[model samples]
Target chain A: MTEHPGRITREDVAHVARLARLRLTDDELDLYTGQLGVILDHAADVASLDLDGVAPTAHAMAVTNVLRSDTPRPGLDRDEVLAAAPEVEQHRFRVPRILGEAP
Target chain B: MDRYQGGGVVTEGWELVIGLEVHCELRTETKLFCGCRNLFGDEPNSNVCPVCLGLPGSLPVLNQRAVELAMAIGTALHCDIRPSTFHRKNYFYPDQAKDYQISQYDEPINVDGWLDLPDGFRVRVERAHLEEDTGKTTHAGASGRIHGADYSLVDYNRSGVPLVEIVSAPDMRTAVQARAYATELRAILIASGASDGKMEEGSMRVDANVSVRRSTDATFGTRCEIKNLNSVRSLGRAIDYEAQRQVALLESGGVVEQQTRHWDEGTGRTETLRSKEEAYDYRYFREPDLVPVVPDAEWKAAVADTLGLMPAQRRARLVELLSGGNGAGGNDGDGDGDGELRVDQIATVVDLGLDDLVVGAVAAGVPATLALARTANEAATDAEAARRLDGSSYVALLTLEASGSLSATQAKVVLGDLLLAGGGDPAMLAKEKGFEAMSADSLVETVGQAVAAEPDAWARYCDGEDKLAQVFVGKVMKATRGQANGKAVVAELQRLRG
Candidate 1:
């Protein structure tokens, strides 16, 4: 459990928006800063609960080991799959200069 | 205590600390969370579905065989299998079509395992966790570098493939030890049937974290992670180069920066990729679409049963066979006279995953030394052909050599023919190639003729200049048209001398 340090600043919102490739206006950044602050406050309230012995739950349902066999099934047709992309070249998904590089 | 000096700049007191992270793709038929075929070299975007492509309203289901193979690796590395869950590692990368990768962060499937290298050193495995592979991005530019690339192409055929990343502790002291660890781990992966261990094809990838510190320092220096180390040789070279770079920097009163470096194989140097401040935070959170995986006792035991003998165990078994005692008899007479197999020969057999071939031949009553030499030297040349070879043929070849029906050289030629062209019996091949072993009496007569003809060489041999014995053996081989066994000729010469 963790606590919210303080109000979410406009700079923080701007930084996140840039990382997400979101072209947010100054007004939008200010609005997001306020809205995100409220969400963080609410999250901190939940985190403030004194449930020391309780286990953290990852899913709401009581399911575990939901897996499929390794056998292959019919996949989407290649033409149909590529048709949905914005661009295609040599049967591949073509994109503009991929920002930095791949890891 | 090997000190690395980078760029010919001597930093004699600095010790290099290296740790490796290896990612091996599991040998599953389908994708990790979809039914798309998990294959390589297929047409781009040919093996994709809505789930793998991250289309709207598509959900992911775990692949059971991938988990089982991950557990098999854990068991082989002596890891503790635990209940694990997946998380969404959020980032902005076109390679990951979803802009987020489904991976295991905190609670991985396998934890706290250790692998023992053939050099008698052990490396602690931090975790062996499962994740989905991203797409392949091919940059197009004059330099072919991403920084100056005009555009890029993406192949989703590799996407959604299952991968298990084995992270090792910073327990390696030198580059040689690091390579040995990777080699042994690759053998274990191949032995466990978890991965094909093809680093060149990108099925198995390695990234090395290297740092240099003063020999007397109690704390570690700053480390840089070097990527693009696709081969074992590249991994070693990158670590050595990076360590020297860091050492040279420190010697000039400069601090080592925490960054990710790219290994330029052509230039044999590491260049800065990005600094820590520019690195992605990879905001991780629990993946809501998937459930936890908890393998019960029975499931673990079943996976354990499927695991074959690991490389170390196989090497030990081969050594036992080479020592000739058979674990019960008083000297079965199969040793190489020194009761030890050469380390390189053992590594060759084990690394090629052909130890079982040698073992099977020995089990069929062929001498261990003969089996080891043939497999290590001859069969190992063509690994693909060797894997398809029948154990009976291998044993037949060795048996022929052991019984003196074919000399060692002749046996190698016949074995090479069998491996390359794949037909004809060993004896038949020997006859067709004019490599038939001469009779003992014929060899005796040839040796007698050689002694009479090469009087000066035979007199030198009889005068305790034993080095001249090769002269008589060579002459006998010439007289017999290379059909006489050299060992037999030598034995006949010794008998005549007596």
Candidate 2:
């Protein structure tokens, strides 16, 4: 029903989930594979639609030249920001090892 | 969760390709697509509204300021400001409650620009577009790991903030150049007044795409995307480390795999985060709720006008002005008063830190030269001192420097004391602090005293131990408590010793 149909498969869905850091179960991955295929296929259909004369819209706001004076306002209150974090030490946001070891 | 899941990683004679997606939060008071506050590091969930929070029944109204800032950046980067439209980039994440992000698809705000490097290489700007920011998420407990974490906390303060995403073409050859390009880009963005461009505050973020290939290969090798590279040094170092890793793998007859990588600042290395995916991953499409974005002719022209005289051009102009004796006279052509006034003007301009502001002040009936000199004199002191010196006191500083009663250096000391003494006059500070320049005659007398004090040094000087002359000069300078002109003292000593 659309161009580029079936380009995305179950493997592609799994790859995407990994990229997005989403831990999806096998059943969810299979469902997303089908759902993503349909969505991309629909996008391909839209990409193929006859709108040669239609102008592409990038922004909805018809405004321009919005500028603030070159004045530096007060920035973040350091102590106040650290208050929201569940755990903070020495003014730094503590996080576990996200990157693995070498070798 | 398994750390590695891909079938095969690319390893030997393979090159890696990279691209960058840099997003800078636009410096504006209001949100990108709404009237809610556009701020960073605010009280948790303080600057949020229904539109930003993705509440049902809330309609979107685009902030005019965000669009203008986007256009300003587009034009500055020399992008073709295509009459384009917006689309919804759909993705479901906990931080983004909207389930879809309203961003430009094929029709970005600007397209096809190049950033010229000093080394004759150019990094092409693929496109720059405007979008709203999502809230931040923090995984807490269990060593604060994203996986196996007890719970994840979300902060909505930054939600719906305006951002300009500047995507660069794969033109960077080395890690150093990529980092340089990023730095220059930040300077331009900051100068343009489009964004605060503060990396520490997370106002500006860089997503680096790095890959390496052989010198002879025409095709690019499998590339890895390195995300979360914070500072300029880290970006370049991460790229270098990743490239070396890839090259080592290739040299060892291994294959390179296409994947997204995460950079660890602590370790100064990159690790596999996830394999790269095709565009279908996000399932991007046009948002049915929002219509296409369109800017009128008048709007475009106004934005163009606002991007007037960037900081680069202003720096050049200031350099020319200083060199041409328009200010800060290096030498007067006719030996006429070397325009101490002009020197003041240059000093003022330098003190203001913003050329445009200085120019504006000059045009506003302020004696440009006097105001500038006064500004310069005040700047050389502490903030308190600068505040203490009333308008009239600055004039006294210029007069002293011009009349040769005090050198520029001494005037600064006097200004500092005046500022620190609070309620003290600069002239009185100079008199009480003995901040006066030594004249030729007084310097000679001090030099004679030093020569007499160090008879052995005088004998060393007469014996052609030329280096001892410096010792004599030092003694003379010390005797005068560094107030004497060491040059004049040296000349006087040479004559007496001979």
Best by TM-score: 1
State the lDDT at B94 in candidate 1.
Answer: 83
lDDT of 2 by residue, B152-209 (tens): 5666667778889999998876666776577667767866778866676788889887
The C-alpha RMSD of each candidate to the native structure, in angstroms, is 7.8, 12.4
**What is the iRMSD of the candidate numbered 2?**
9.0
Return the clash pairs for model 1, or none: B6-B244
* Overall lDDT per candidate, in order of appearance: 0.83, 0.65
Off by over 4 Å in 1: A1-7, B1-10, B325-341, B400-498
Could you tell me the TM-score of candidate 2? 0.62
Instruction: Write out fnat for all predictions, comma-separated.
Output: 0.84, 0.04
Residue B429, candidate 1: Cα error in Å is 6.9
TM-score of chain A of 2: 0.68
Query: What is the Cα-based lDDT of residue B16 in candidate 2?
Result: 44
lDDT of 1 by residue, A1-103 (tens): 2323475777888887776779998878767787888898988898999989998887899788999999999889999988888988888888999766565
Summing lDDT over every window of 10 consecutive residues in candidate 2 chain B, give the lowest-scoring window.
Answer: B1-10
For model 1 the local lDDT of residue A89 reads: 88
